[model samples]
Target chain A: MTDAVSARERILARVRAAVANAPEAAAVARDYRTSHTADDPAAVLGLLHENLADYRAHVHRTAPDGLAALVAERLAERGARSVAVPPGLPDAWLAATDAVRRPDEPRLSPYALDGIDAVVTGCALAIAETGTIVLDGGPGQGRRALTLVPDLHVCVVLAPEQVVASVPLALPRLDPGRPLTWISGPSATSDIELDRVEGVHGPRTLEVILVTGG
Target chain B: MGMPSFPEAAREAVGDTTLRANLRHATHTIRDKRARAVAELDDWAALREAGKRIKDDTLRHLDTYLVRLEAAVTAAGGTVHWAADAAEANRIVTALVRATGETEVVKVKSMATQEIGLNEHLEAEGIAAYETDLAELIVQLGEDRPSHILVPAIHRNRAEIRDIFAEKMGSWGRPAPDGLSDTPAELAEAARLHLREKFLRAKVGISGANFMVAETGTLVVVESEGNGRMCLTLPETLISVVGIEKVVPSWRDLEVFLQTLPRSSTAERMNPYTSMWTGTTDEDGPSAFHLVLLDNGRTDALADEVGRQALRCIRCSACLNVCPVYERAGGHAYGSVYPGPIGAILTPQLRGTSSEIDASLPYASSLCGACYEVCPVAIDIPEVLVHLRERVAEEGGKGHRLEKAAIKAASWVLDRPNTLAAVERLASATRKVHPKRLPGPGARQWSDHRDLPELPAEPFRDWWRKNRP
Candidate 1:
């Protein structure tokens, strides 16, 4: 069997030879709009709320002080017995919740996390145009598994500050080194006769809390 | 070992009424939804143009970008292995799985892996590979080939899918619950339960990336189901077999595709999940990451300036949905893992026009240009089809033998106006007695589905002379 080192050299040589006589392609013209909607923060916030709900995510709004109560209420409504909390999640965020808090210092195993009822975490950012919430394994957002294994994901997006108008605006602000998961709605599949069916492998129910006015 | 020609395969598929009904319902539903989704953006034209340019630029300097990507992935603590062909890629992956001492692997739906036939290769090596996506799971359970790029089981309706699950799930791992129904929700739930056990225990995971950012060494997988997340995050070792053409120059280049891909594919503003990870991180996700760069027939494809534009495809399957021929003939007729308009052009170029299926693929289209219109990257599929048709003609394949004969016969008759007129009059006189279909081997296949045109009572010249005089 040919080794990898020679394989690399041969493949690159073939690629160079393939395009040797080809015309030089023109430079990319990026005249596309950075944001589809208006620049106003309030309008962007409203679009985020509208689009997220359009994909069937439950959307709510609360003040900074009312956040703990809203989180607790959503978890209680799901009847969650335990919630996986990321390491840097604020204590005040889950203070009012009656569900047991399973911290991730030791890092929950896939089986252990499977048994947990829900996961609550903060986000790196959210895109208004696409209705996507991005988690980059940040302080409050645990590893990728934390949000994946649980049936219910209650993600808190700090409005205006954590929200952007479009995908183009969202990429530069993110760090590429960390693992990123961009979720628009709860897990969905159009596999069955091309009809949209929500609740597949990821969180079946995604509840977004847009906390405003600290 | 000659495969049936495209016309032969398509004729068999077109005759299946159940398959036609399943395809029509699925394609029509997604076509309208995709149109509405794309209509929401005002600068869609500009985005399409930009997407085309970015892909073109990447292809032109693919060697440099690939080298840069290798350096970045290695710098970020990921091992990069290069494969010149399918056999080498299979060997590399089999060795990786063997080194880990794992007999089973969970797979996310990937066209590259399907192209390489990775599952069968591993199974031959005494390893069991489980497909995790809901659509892929259905195809695997049914012992069928993928019919669509996005929804592999598009040909299987709800009832067929439920039946496949009810019968086949047990032998694979988990059994479907008693009394399975035809509803989409219940079937999806059954898949979720059946795969959850494998997700939690698998030691090795395999996948293909939608886009690999050369700048940051980040591999991105865009998917709707959470099965992708499970196969990606839970496994201790992750192996991604990516085509060499899947590279982009910068991290920010994802903006264009991140916006256009979802709308074109699933007709959603965004898919439910899009995962991007650069190599491996400490105590997060996979502990060991391997990036296998595959160039199986890709370098050959890049040689043709006109055909190389096919490499720009993002695998949106929009072309498949809009194509009229694809609507009736179905995807399996394309005789490739890639199906539809994109496949017609792509398969022939990658594999060449030597085989019967590959030669016939170039002629599969009516060239209505719907695939070109719906293409997000603006691949101009018709131009490639025509180009490949020329190659097929030059290469001298079986399908074109009758084509050349007919053209020769036509020129001979047209050389003499007297013979042409006499022949026309003869055809006119025999109009009632003329057969609906032609006779002979290749000619019969052509006339089987098409009716010969109704002949006029007299030639046009006779009518012109009689009236004018």
Candidate 2:
């Protein structure tokens, strides 16, 4: 066997030994059941909506063709004037809106991003069961900071790209060398008295754009 | 520094009624909120199980995963340094800061950094380290060590915080507003203003990670306040010191932890700001990023089979909130950067049960199993505590030897029932002369608080012989 294969085998053997010796391994392994059940894109999107609402995150859906229009109209409704746009954002996505589009640049400071009215980016991956959108700084996702700084963030999730799967399945798709941010919901906290407060540090408003029939 | 003895520290903590009241109220509130937040999701149990499995699996193959992580991080234009101990870690970090020619560095609340006393070390090297996290800032300004993991200033009430702010906020940068009151909003405002100035001026930033993904070489930090974001993004150079055990196998594995950690800790469904970065991005955030992979006592901790599981802790502080002993003793009594149940097990293992403090830490818990029930990673804290008690008994030598001799004599006597009966009769004859309290010096402390059970007039064995047995 090659050295790499030998190393892999050795590591796997050690892991097997460790697991066998672990006091509660059998019990824990039996409890970890795969939960993915959505059949198609529409099913996945539906699950996302259910889970998001369950987590108290505001969710919005629209047709693929009407996405830009819907996003523009949503931005307008929210009184957003300048939207931070990721570098790989589709130009046509923002074409319908008259709001000033601020391209996400490398040197942009948190203060600058805070000044922008809103941020729009494409997700690297989305887990439907948890209503989580992961931004990996890949293509339209831009830098992690861009999505974080602004008070309002609108994330675009393509129907087929998002999955209703377990973390084990999603593991293979992600690159280890990318800046990955997994966001379940908008930033929030509860004080010492158990009073829940939203938008303590990250974005106050998180609007999910589910582009269907893509 | 070594952990102090648990019984002595706990005795001191138990006597402070005010501290006890504060801790009881604070911990109970967080524990209830955490329970409610976790209960909201039906899949919380599954998520917790998944988290435990992932962490266990990753830790099992930690060496391989760490190498993979290093390669990934190096490929992504980041440098990874391995430090076998705290001194090594501090040296590497101070060297990095010195190389940058910066006199001051802004810091995120990193448990690893605190574990090694990096700030004090940095100060000794003539470099100033400013804590940017609000709780840490309060700790630094007040010249106090953190007592609680999540809320370091948890022991201090709002009025104390207001006083700390009013007195120290100006020296840092921005002063507390003219009429700073003991209100959350006012304190938060003062902290925000004070930290903003430091964030803008600092040339370097230091931090710790909640999780480091090996597959992607991505470092993740989840925080409630925006201070971490500022410290991470504002500095020209970023340095993160993270424990080796913090590495997860993959980004997907992060899902399990992300779900369980927030609800268990800060009682949030999700933290406000979860910052993740791979490496240096051209002109985005910090141009330079360096990761210090700290081992310190981890390899030593990993050596023991039963004791190693303490490493799986994500520093969520859930154990602290639920600990009855920690609720009384507070954080300062523990002496180590880690406090409470997790601290009681972890500190001794890391530092060894050599000192008065380290030796005593194992006995700090009531072994109520509340900590085990709430632990996200399912660390059997009571099991570890008992195991450490054995270790301490072995280390102490005198007690174990005496106990062994007494056990041997009892066994011999039990082997001969007639002799046992005779001895029991003699004990009953001498019962009137026996004192209620133990006669020994140390025995007084135990008897002072608790009454020794009265010896029966007739031995149980004698009664059994006379009756049906």
Candidate 3:
């Protein structure tokens, strides 16, 4: 701890010495618009859907009533036999799915999550402009590892409410205290000659079901 | 620990056909896509300007933000440590790990840690630090220096990577699967499997953040792979060594950077994953979190008015991708953890121009201004390079006196119209005496790379006077 104390003082003193003559605020000329102009919320939602698909995330839109059915259909399509489900997720969200639901509990190891076919969770928020879904492990989103280890992830976004037009708009709505995971698309890598090949270490397949009715 | 100067190492790298091919293909591919991605945004220039301003504001008021960040992180139950230099950082980190009684640690991809050479220091103190990033793992296993900032092993192609994995992975941990091929997917799988066990068992995790919020003490790491997530979540004790300049005044200020960084670096709308956490949480990720604020050479760099712009760099490799020099000479030529255009400016400023390598770095760039063009934060790297060049000449005495005298004489002659005209006539009369190649030591150095422009037959000024009024 003493190591930190001395280093802190010395570093701060040096910093003070260095920037002493600098302007008081150097107030950022934040003239940049917060987001692209798309005044309509519906247009924002459409942009989110389009951008999500553009980023290669499988995007599907459905009413509240059809949400569970879409989830079930998506699981079937992904060939998932078992799904890792967080406890706080509404029970009805998975009522239609025949895939065995693996609820979050103690003794859930990273190894077990790896064996699970897919992970289904509700995101904290989604960014329309960048085509990103953010999961904070709040209710529906299980531990970070649950969504990560599995080969596929099906994230449900409550559009219009959970979606924002841009990153600036999204940051305020989200809680910083919680561990936030902003996913633009499925796990991807451009490591080889800048050739983007989706599906790497994280969930290779990302499916976003936009539940607009709720 | 022994490394050669930039000119010394870059000479070999320049002649390396394989490294050249790898860098050329990678840089060209990323550079074109980056342009298209950047073009998609209509307000890109505004965003870039805002990014620059935000960083300037933060750096100008760095002391205030740092103290606020320390308080916020402490309030959230995370301890913050300060390190004045690399040795201090290493000592504090090693002592923390030893106190935990852990012999091994899993690390997320972190440039700050790499810059401080933490892995070697930890090893010297009998602690094994595992690098889990796919590219970093390859570099570590192959015993190679990182050539590029984003992709540490950019000098190595897929086949070279596969061979490194096959030959070296076993001694480290889980060996690459039998008969590993050169495919990117296969290589990624080998890394995932080899590093997963280490991730699960390790009690200690080390990382560097992309941005740190002063308002909430939230540390954010923007990455693609799940390895960062695993290290962030699974470990009981997490240690993050971040540069002092990484902090922003507030979360709202963070908005400007998040927009520009991804597009500039990887040319993506958004990177695959972004992790943000505030100190420690109960019954959640890491119960114990430590933030090590590093100021190794940052204060020195900040003291400089013209050189301070280099600190605005977000570690995006866009400048490197677009740099003609970097595409040929590769990363190792910079002779520091950072490389390419950003490195050419940053390394010299941080390390000072005393070392041969540091002195050589200011001359590494062609001053083409491609780096300044694509810089998200608008770091004027060429300006800093020229600034550092003056410092190197004045202090390091690397600039030759003959070149200086020649430039002074040319200025004296050109300053007077009559003297300039007389000299032009003299040069035209003695054109044959000028020779096809310079007769001094410069002849060999000049002919080795390129040809002289035949002295242009006659000076442009004389031709203009004779033909026109």
- Tell me, by lDDT, which candidate is best: 1
lDDT of 3 by residue, B1-469 (tens): 3567777888898899998999999999889888988887888998899888888888888999999999999999899999999999999899889989999999988999998999999999999999988888889999998888888888889999999999999999899999899989888888878987787687999999999999999999988877788789888899999999999889887788888889988998889888889988776778899999999999999999999988888998999999998998999888888999999988887788777788888889889999999999999999998888878767736554665678679889879999887787777778777655556686667766776665557788878978996
Best-fitting candidate, scored by DockQ: 1
Q: Candidate 1, residues B320-437: lDDT per residue as tens digits?
A: 9999999999989999999999999999887888888989898899999999999999999999999998788877776577677877899999998999999999989988899888
Q: Candidate 2's error at B211, in angstroms?
A: 3.1
The DockQ values of the predictions, listed in order, are 0.88, 0.23, 0.68
After TM-score superposition, what is the CA distance of residue B451 in candidate 3 from its true location, in Å?
Answer: 4.6
In candidate 3, stretches whose alpha carbon ends up further than 4 angstroms from where it belongs are: A23-26, B396-399, B408-421, B428-434, B447-469
Give per-residue CA lDDT, model 1, range A90-121, as digits (tens): 99999999999999889899999999999999
lDDT score at residue A129, model 1, on the 0-100 scale:
90
- Whole-model lDDT per candidate: 0.94, 0.78, 0.87
For model 3, the docking class works out as medium
lDDT of 2 by residue, B174-230 (tens): 888989987666676677667666766678999999999898888989886666876
Supply the TM-score for candidate 1: 0.93
Query: Which CAPRI tier for candidate 2?
Result: acceptable
